[model samples]
Target: MSRPSVWAPKIVALIKGGNSSAAIAQIKVAPTVKDLQDLRKLLIAANLLKPHPNVDAATNDMIAELSAPRLHRSP
Candidate 1:
């Protein structure tokens, strides 16, 4: 896998290990449309993402993606 693709398993392990990095970061807890798309990737890869693959992951992931301090937007 490429560097970016590898991030998925790491987050999955975090979830499987019962860690809440997002909560610790005080994530937004409710993401916007852009963050939702990002989170869907993570959750789906982690296999905790859905009964409906088309559905959004928990608001936490969305929030985490949305409100995690400052960051770059994909180009």
Candidate 2:
């Protein structure tokens, strides 16, 4: 089984405590794209963040970059 994320609880606590800036900082350094996405959802659900066009575009770009297949060069 997969291990739990280390940042989720901290982020949730920060959100609940109305510390959005700190939560955003933690989200910035989240280990995986899935973590980032999940944190974004939490922020939205808490009304701390809104889904703006620019933000969505940037997120989509990040998701694309992070999830894109890598090409291995011949050694």
Candidate 3:
């Protein structure tokens, strides 16, 4: 778990000390798009991003396309 104190130590301290409003005011419930993009970049940099492919479905689609008959035109 990430240390809650990293972003707002004073807010965390206030919460532990039972100050609700101040803690709530200091807390960020939502991250910005930039923050999400930065996190994605970080995960990619750490090689932790694993993308899985639907191999069977892809293969079946390819086979279907390949098996479809092609029409020829006379010159």
TM-score of each: 0.33, 0.52, 0.29
At residue 64, candidate 3 shows an lDDT of 50
**lDDT tens digits by residue: candidate 2, 32-54:** 78876765676577665553434
Model 2 worst lDDT run, 10 consecutive residues: 51-60
Q: Which predicted model would earn the best lDDT?
A: 2
- Stretches of candidate 2 off by over 4 Å are 51-75
- TM-score of structure candidate 2: 0.52
RMSD of 1: 8.2
Q: Per-residue lDDT for 20 in model 1?
A: 53
Candidate 3 residue-wise lDDT at 11: 33
Model 3 lDDT tens row, 1-75: 753223333433454465645544433331333333343344355433343123223323444544557576578
Considering TM-score, which of the candidate structures 1 and 2 is the better prediction for this target? 2
Output the lDDT of residue 60, model 1.
47
Error at 52, model 1, angstroms:
16
